[model samples]
Target: MALAQRLFRTKPTEQIVAEGGHGEGGELRRTMSLWQLTLFSVGATLGTGIFVILGQAVPKAGPAVVLAFVLAAITALFSALSYAELAGSIPVSGSSYSYAYATLGELVAWICGWCLMLEYAVSVAAVSVGWGEYLNSFLEGLFGWSLPAAITHSPGQDGGVVNVTAILIVLLATWLLLRGASESATANAVFVLIKIAVLVFFCVVAFTAFRAGHFSPFAPMGVAGVTAAASQVFFSYIGFDAASTAGEEAKNPKRDLPLAIILSLAIVTIVYVLVAVAAIGAMPWTDFDPERTEASLSYIVNLATGATWPGLIVSFGAVVAIASVVLTVIYGQTRILFAMSRDGLIPHIFQKVNPRHQVPVANTLIVAAFISVLAGLVPLGQLAEATSIGTLFAFAIVNIGVLVLRYRSPDLPRSFRTPLFPATPVLGTIFCVIVMAGLAGVTWLAFGLWMLAGLICYFLYGYSHSRLNTEVPR
Candidate 1:
């Protein structure tokens, strides 16, 4: 085959679906129901972002931050519809990676997979770093003492060395995933419930102290500010990709994956809007201190009730919430590699599944170890921005994939389709680009380096070993 032919060769849809479960030790077992699938996405997404987003975004958009969340949700809704359509039709472990392979070909599929690596892996590390800070707050609130800053903070920050709690949480998530998908989902459901209840409690308490005046000059910062904040808030909606990634494990993938993706986004947006309203109601947006963002939600609760206990509850909830993100994102990271490995794009180490547990044992552990090191030792302030850009890039490609597949295979069966045909996907791609444009120059530079590295790796190994021309038994 010519070089370009090999690079752009599309994987047959029938073969992609046929090879769904095969791997090194054994095939992945289907144990996830629609509920578990939905919660997994919820657990991955509903993290400390909302707890801190108010402090960070509220100042940017003022009381109209609520509108920012709505705007972000609308942009995500466009991509979510595309995700739903492709997820329902394709239904594989790779999510957008697989979708791209079936439409855009090997190089684009590999690039999409590469972007997911940055999205899931780097976000896991960034969120875990925040976990240590919340753990200290919870400890201090309940016992009047905090973990030593040295052990709790990452290296090069203050007198800190390694973030012990950050590493501990990643290791804990690794152990949970090693157990099995069903077991991990069950534990995530419990964590999700706890975090949701805590947010609800804050809403109830803040409502009593509600002041409508805070929302009077809601557009204090104008449309420009609201648009900027929406770009930041849109990242919080990133984890619904977890639902699409779980396609191979879902019991009724074609029917349930689309539902889970859309349903999870709906639940997250509702929670976000309610909490945004409550936080602003309890305190003036002008008073939101960006310096203490991670404690923003709990800080509002403390000020509202004038008690240490309520704030403590919120802090404790944050610890659980960040830990939940670590678990689910790790699961997502491993599964992406699992799909790539099976396609001969990456090393086979990721392809090895534990036959009895029906999970990628080694893949999970390796990912956890790498993420823990980043969380414990690296200062992730700038590196974390890459997560947003990488995710937006993958989403745009998926939206394009939907447009291509619909044109190429009009007869292909689809469980769900994006409404408005080309408009849906066309807008989805445009929205993704708009968000990507809002990202910082440093983020774009980092993403560029990551993609360069990925392209080099693809040519060095992936192109020669791709399974497009290789026959495998289904």
Candidate 2:
């Protein structure tokens, strides 16, 4: 009983806040303003998915993919509300992991942090591969020359040797991260504007070719297809909570974190709905080819204008957009690891901060090295399912953490609260599980294997070395 209690030890909310909570660098500054935080959320959330997912989702839901985007948005909103409430109340660095530690226990927090590695790290690697493809496309258009297939494609792709451009982009983002958080957020805001402009332009052009006949068989694949597509579209909404990860750095974390979470979702949902509606109306749903849809936005533009310049412009925008995704996702990864390290759940090296930059330099480099290798050598076409499932798992935990906190600490001053109380979190958890159930069997097996590996590490290292066990009085 004693050992069990210790293993499931929950960190007191006050201690969590007071234990050098700015993370390892006690002077980690709060430089992000409300506008910058919102832009970061918008930028991180507006990743390669909007540019790539339409092809896959359109084929699944036909013209009703617009409805699928709405459905996915609704599903994500439930969790987003939970995130806002907790972020407002806790204002911690480790996104859901820190929330879980405060409301649940160490074991759960460790698991949540481990799953985030999948959501952020692997996702960055996958997005980096995409960045390489679009970069090659842009270069081929501008200079009539592109990197060789071996250097631009991942292994098992067109006999690829290594994705050198993918590795390069990851290294570039890593260099930016080593500079500091404020610089990265400013750069991300610029990227967000470029992405929004490109999407808005695509919508305007696509509407010129809109036809009502496209709606004749809107739900051609039925309700099942809509649900399936929504499940996948959910991936497009993955990085909205990224703003929550910036809790420690926000100038007004309690107010800005919640606003950023809600506002970012609202912005991305509007863009997704408009783009989906415009794309479906502009082209026959039957004509959306999955194999050729990787460059779907550019393809849509080319079809609308009957010219190549628009497609080239969209491709250039895509290269820029995906590069920003890689940047923000990798940034989120390092912070989560830094938090875990501060709790002594990982090596101390990750928690060390560079006094000059006020950033976890070691943590950033290690994560960058690992993600770059994956980007260069791995074929991540199928890894997206794993990423989706991992995110849903984290969402489910965050929802549960909210409910637990509300019951356990009713008087905790919250800058924001889930509007419907238990209903919001309950529905959020249920929807996340339902979406997760749509994934393939292989994905579950892989997730399980990953979790098992995490547990092994916890028992061997984290359990013994955890700050909660060693420092906090039992």
| Cα lDDT computed for each candidate against the true fold | 0.90, 0.87
Residue 393 local lDDT, model 2: 89
State model 2's lDDT. Answer: 0.87
Model 2: per-residue Cα lDDT over 321-421, one tens digit each:
88788888888898888888889999998888888888888889999999989999977665655887888889999999999999999998999999988
Residue 68 displacement (Å), model 1? 1.0
What's the residue-level lDDT of 293 in candidate 1?
A: 89
Model 1's TM-score against the true structure? 0.97
